[model samples]
Target: MFFSKLVMAALAATVLAEKTPVTPLLLANFERYAAFASAAYSSDCANPPFNSTVVRYINDVPTDTQATLFRDDIAQQFIISFRGTSDIQDFVTDLDQVLVPCVAQGIQCPTCLCWQGYLIQYNAVANTVKSAIDAGLLQYPGYSLVVTGHSMGGALASLAAASLDGQGLPLIAYTYGQPRTGNQAYANLIDSAFNGTMYRLTHTNDGVPQIPAQSDGYRHHSREYWQSDDPPTIENTFQCQGQEPSDCNQSEPGYGIGNGGIGINAAHLSYFGISTGNPLDPNAAC
Candidate 1:
């Protein structure tokens, strides 16, 4: 009985040691991203059918950071997209003049066509993230920074992650339904630079990530990809039908899919509270 009681005490201690406290810096980062979403959704460039849809999409997706009290303390930081300000004619002219040629002759050039527009938008978001970091809004020095997005947002997150990595920052990025941004060499470089920080999530039937340049060297992370058949729950179903959602089934014990792994539940929108199984130890620096 003493031995069993001791084992139980040890387990309790382990659990207590693992609990993470929510920090103000983390809360600031969440608010910063929220502002980014609000601004992106409100942008005039977020036009027509997409504008409304994007707004709702941003609103519906959850963040792990919101569960903490820090949510109320951070100052709001709003970002205005250049695309939102540019008239359609000017936007097209800029795209034709600046972005199109970047991917024109590449191996993934054909597939990159659609991403051209998204790249421009991502640059804006990256700038926003950088600005926040620079201003000391997000002050954690050792925390792992992850940039993520779903569908087009995933592409944007990829670019943002790459941009941050280039600046000699330590960060990781996981994109869902992300298109191929560049050639294999480029993708390889991104993977290496980010220390394999890039993880792509896909739903089996979701066609967005299948665009050109995606299949070459891109590595996917998910439980369904390797495990036996598990029926999708209403909570876990991908919005797009017929696609197998690449939720992070392989995440370590602390980071559960519902908590922090990638899937429809783990997409850029829902990352804040996804348990990640590895709950942050409150005693540790936030």
Candidate 2:
């Protein structure tokens, strides 16, 4: 354990140094990306911001998981979103925490290992999501891709972002109340791929990110945007030092572990003061 901490300390230093060079985040964009994350819950996608964008499709054929694809011609971006846990299937997905090989075609992670359930969630819609993204890109040339999700949807967003990285597509991921999706190698893969563009936001006392337990061989990727105080605001948020930084959300005992890795807590429910819905309506049906 001592030697492991030393290694992680050295790696954290290196990751932090290189992290300064990535694209700058616009605080205003947090609200925008968050809007998309929340929109994933609305069944009809008739929410305010979503209503304004060109809706591509909402893939929920499995009913267990759902992802949304849309185009913002004004911003010239193809945005994809996944809804948080609203079904028993998603809870089952979250509980199936066994580590597995990330062998999804196009992902270059030869040695990477990921949480089984999260990868399954990603695989469920990977083909359709990619196809929609490809079509959207072709239709709107020069537009980049953005992926956002809350809770389990956040886990899917990470997998989707990694998948996009494999395709060498321009992309960014903003996930709220996300869990640890993989091991150190998997986290490193994502950190290297997006540098600063991977916004893994954690709200105060959010239990989700605390498990698939780090003790179980899962490690979060570099950088964490933490809301250290309640009533989350730009002023109260802090960009943490490195992957799994102790000074940020890691400072508090999260919701996931206390419930034995299941059950929803308030912090995991609403991000940026928006109700992402409960188990009854994972998608807000907006």
Candidate 3:
């Protein structure tokens, strides 16, 4: 009787913990950082909330490798965020995948064909981030590292995060509109590697997360945070949905495909807690 009572108490406590809301400040910061990741110009880099210094900015135009490294002194953190697809090259990258040696050891995984373009970019950027971390820690002690991106950038961030896995630091990744980066083996590798540190955020009706299609054997990391509103009028509406193959993303009706064509574009651009402006509007037709 006593043990049954204790189990019920513990379950109640867990439920209470899950119901606890995310703070406004953290959500605001995520918005700012995500927007910062999507920025295209040096002028766009002027974010006041962060006394941000751009450590490295790479724009190998039209090939889906536009990434930036910023040291946020205000937050005392380093953010490595990638920008999404902007041209034909990015689309090509999405279509291209090649089988590479599995990242996890002793796992006789199937032939996994990871995103080729993201793999190349991750290799180069991972080295830069490591070097920066080694140097930055001396300059700014106790600073944490955050990896983030949108769309194709998010895919690259996932690959980069996997590469940086097992490093002796608490790493956090927040990716938006990120499509699948690899097969089941790669997804499992990330789950084991990053564990609880990776958060994949998807907005309602967002089509990007639904493809390069899971039917192709691509899978997403667990613990997805879903936004169910358009323009996101309220705060902290994001709910934690655990993994795919359940009722998340394409699994739900009127979300992945039901949003229609415009919905997909809107979902990709809006980061929910962040701005609602379309990042593709300016150059959408250009």
Off by over 4 Å in 3: 1-26, 40-44, 60-64, 102-113, 233-236, 251-264, 273-286
**Model 3 over residues 1-286: C-alpha lDDT tens digits?**
9999999999866643442234565456556656655653232454522557777666654344666678878778887777676666766766665546544322333664576667766665565666776687778879988888777778877766665555665678888877777877777777777666787877776777877656666677775666556544335335453456334445446444312222246566777555422543422211
Q: After superposing candidate 1, which stretches have Cα over 4 Å from the reference?
A: 1-114, 213-286
Q: Model 2, residue 188: displacement in angstroms?
A: 0.9
lDDT of 1 by residue, 1-286 (tens): 9999999999876644432222454333433333332233222323321122121112111110101111111222212111111134323522321224223211232322324565545443444456555443354343344455444455555656556666766654544444445444445455456543455543333333444323333332221111111232233322221112323222233332222323222222222222111113111112
> For model 2, what is the error of residue 230's alpha carbon versus the real structure, in angstroms, after optimal superposition?
3.1
Q: Report RMSD for candidate 1.
A: 15.1
Cα-lDDT of candidate 2: 0.76
Model 3 vs. true fold: TM: 0.75
On residues 30-93, what C-alpha lDDT tens digit does candidate 2 reach at each position?
6677778877877676653644463565555564778878677778787898887776777787
Q: Which consecutive 10 residues in model 1 have the weakest lDDT in total? A: 60-69
In model 2, residue pairs whose N, Cα or C atoms come closer than 3 Å (at least 3 residues apart or on different chains), thus clashing, are 41-283, 41-284, 207-255, 207-256
Question: Pick by TM-score: which candidate is best?
Answer: 2
**Could you report the Cα RMSD, in angstroms, for every candidate shown?**
15.1, 5.3, 6.8
